[model samples]
Target: MLKLAVAPVPYHWPRARILSFYADLAKAPCEILYLGETVCAKRRALTPQDWLDLAETLRAAGKEVLLSSLSLIEAASEVSTQRRLCAGSEFLIEANDLGAVTRLRGREFVAGPGINLYNPRFLTRLHALGMRRWIVPIELSRQGLETMQAHCPVDVETEVIGWGRLPLAHSARCFTARVQGLAKDECALSCADHPDGLVLYTQNEQPFLCLNGVQVQSALSHCLIDAVETLQQLGIHSLRLIPQSEGFDAVLRTFDQVRRGATTASSAVEALGRLAPTGLCNGYFHGISGMDWVAPPQVPQGQASLDAPAPRKQ
Candidate 1:
């Protein structure tokens, strides 16, 4: 059975809200939960020990817990945090950067989407170092995944980012800081002001990208609720749902129903639309551009289809 894993929250929220959010997640139907700071090191909403404590709570509730490392390492403090995450024996570690990969020498780890795993050689090296599973990079198309999977060891678990805003790139320079007339070094945690991320717009008032501290993401959420069947056919072991501010519980339940064959893909997609901040997208899965939506030829005859129109490029 395909499992549901909630990726760690990317934006920084208030401490009280963060705690409440996790408490709610504890009751959600997700089987796996990733905890820890995977973005800017200065967020400080949760310390390393704080994340471990949350992991313990989730583990007690029969959820598999994985600790995530920062996507960009800019300071000695960040490197130390990575080492501490790698040293922990209590939970699985998700390495988001090459620096984390280097420190996770003999331990089992997860190659996060940020780590470049475009070729068989890279996968082989990680496998040799005990990489148990990996999430495909957001830009890699379905055909690319097929090629990589053909050469991947059968025992290695393959996961995909099935939901949430597509994380495009990460950098040492904070774009949000620039927007606020602040430098990356002196930026006073401006990301917290926008729980879901500050929306960037084009000159004509069109939504473009989202600025989440040092990470830049697609304005439209990359949704694959309608691609569950195709993902299963491609031998994907699990579907990852990145945490957002709202409707997460409903999102998990919808995916669960679709994965269990209790609900149709289109039905799940419609349910997702009612819950997500933006409309769903499956372009990256169809081998079209990352923003296009190519409806499946067969739509379970007579069922009401809820597919999106073809994408219009900006």
Candidate 2:
């Protein structure tokens, strides 16, 4: 059976909201819960101890927990924090960067999505360094994964972003801070105001992307409700669902039902619209433009433009 893991929160949620979110998740069908901040280090709504405390709580509920590290190591203090996260033995560490990988060489760890493991040889090296599983990057298409999976190093598991707004890029510059005309160091933590993320639009008023501190995500939510069978055929081990502000619990139930053949993909997609902030896209999974959605067996390519407006439920 394919396991479902809830990926770490990518947005700057309030501390109380974060606690409340997991409290609900403690009974969700998700088998694994990725705990900790993998985005900006400045979003300190939950400290290290707080994350560990949450992890302990989830584990007591029989959920497997993993701690994720920031994708970018910006400063010395961030590196030190990464070191501390890797030093712990209670939970699996999702290594999003080389620094985390270096610290977790001897320990069984998960290679997170941000770590660019493109080829089998590179993945093999990570496997040698105790990478038990690897979260396939958001850009890799179905064909790309099939090729890579054929040559997967020993005992390594594969996971993909099943649904949610795709995290497209990260930068050293704090976009939310810059938007406020404030310096990175002196700017107030403004990302918390937009729990989902600060939306970005083009001059034509077309929604293009979202700015969550240093991370820029695609405006179109990347969904794979229709790809569950393909995943099973490919020997994929897990599906990772990134946390969103609303409708996530329902999303979990829908995906589980779809995976089990209890619901049609069309029905699940109907329910999915209520969960995604924008209309869905799976183009990158089809070897097309990442902004498009391509259904299998020669279903006509549907181009989901960057200006795709958030969908409303009927």
Candidate 3:
């Protein structure tokens, strides 16, 4: 059976709210939970120890926790932080960057979505170094995954981003701060203002993208709640669900019900729409553009309902 994992908090939530959120996750159906900061270095809503503290609570709740590393390494301090995360993390490390993998070379780790695993040879090299599970990058099509898994080690687990806005790109410069006319250095913590991430719109008022500190994301929510069978057939073992600000618990429940056969895929898709209401996109899975919602034939049959997007309040 495939595992249902929750990625770390991508939004810049307040410390208190973050604490409360994980406390609630104790009751959620999440089997695997990836913790720690993976986005901006400035969003220090929780300290290393604070995250570990929550890890203990989550583990008690029967969730396997993993510490995630930053995707973009900007400075020596960040390198030091990654090394420290690998060395001291109570749980296995999720290597978003190669440097994290280097630090965790002799130990087990999950390859995060930031790493490109398109080449089976490259994946083989990582598997030799202790990559137990690999998260297929958001852009790679299902065909790419099929090819990689054919040659990779049998023990290597495959996980995919099942939902949430796809994190597209990351840079040293903070676009969220830049748009607000603030330098990355002296900019206020503006990310805290837009908890779900600051929405970026096109000139014609179409949803274009979103800004989450240094990370750029898709405007439409990426979903695969309807593609459970495809994932199972592809030999994938985990569905990584990124945390959203609202309707997160519902998202977890819906995915769980769908995966466990308790509810139909159509019913799960409806629940996801109500919980999030953001337009759905599954193009990347079909080897097309990342912004289109092209569901496979085996998935539930229905027009995706995204009438009310999650409010973008400051």
Instruction: Rank the models by TM-score, top first.
Output: 2, 3, 1
Cα error, candidate 3, residue 72 (Å): 0.7
Backbone Cα, N, C clashes tallied per candidate: 0, 0, 0
Instruction: List runs of model 3 lying over 4 Å from the truth.
Output: 295-314
lDDT of 3 by residue, 30-149 (tens): 789889889987789898888888888888888888889988998888888888888987698899998888888789988998897789888888889999998998888878878877
TM-score of 3: 0.93
lDDT of 2 by residue, 137-165 (tens): 88789999999999996599999889888
Which residue pairs overlap in candidate 3's backbone?
Answer: none
Alpha-carbon shift of residue 42 in model 1 (angstroms)? 0.4
Candidate 2 has which clashing residue pairs, if any? none
Q: Pick the candidate with the highest lDDT.
A: 2
Task: Looking at model 3, report the run of 10 residues with the lowest lDDT sum.
Answer: 305-314
Per-candidate local distance difference test: 0.82, 0.85, 0.83
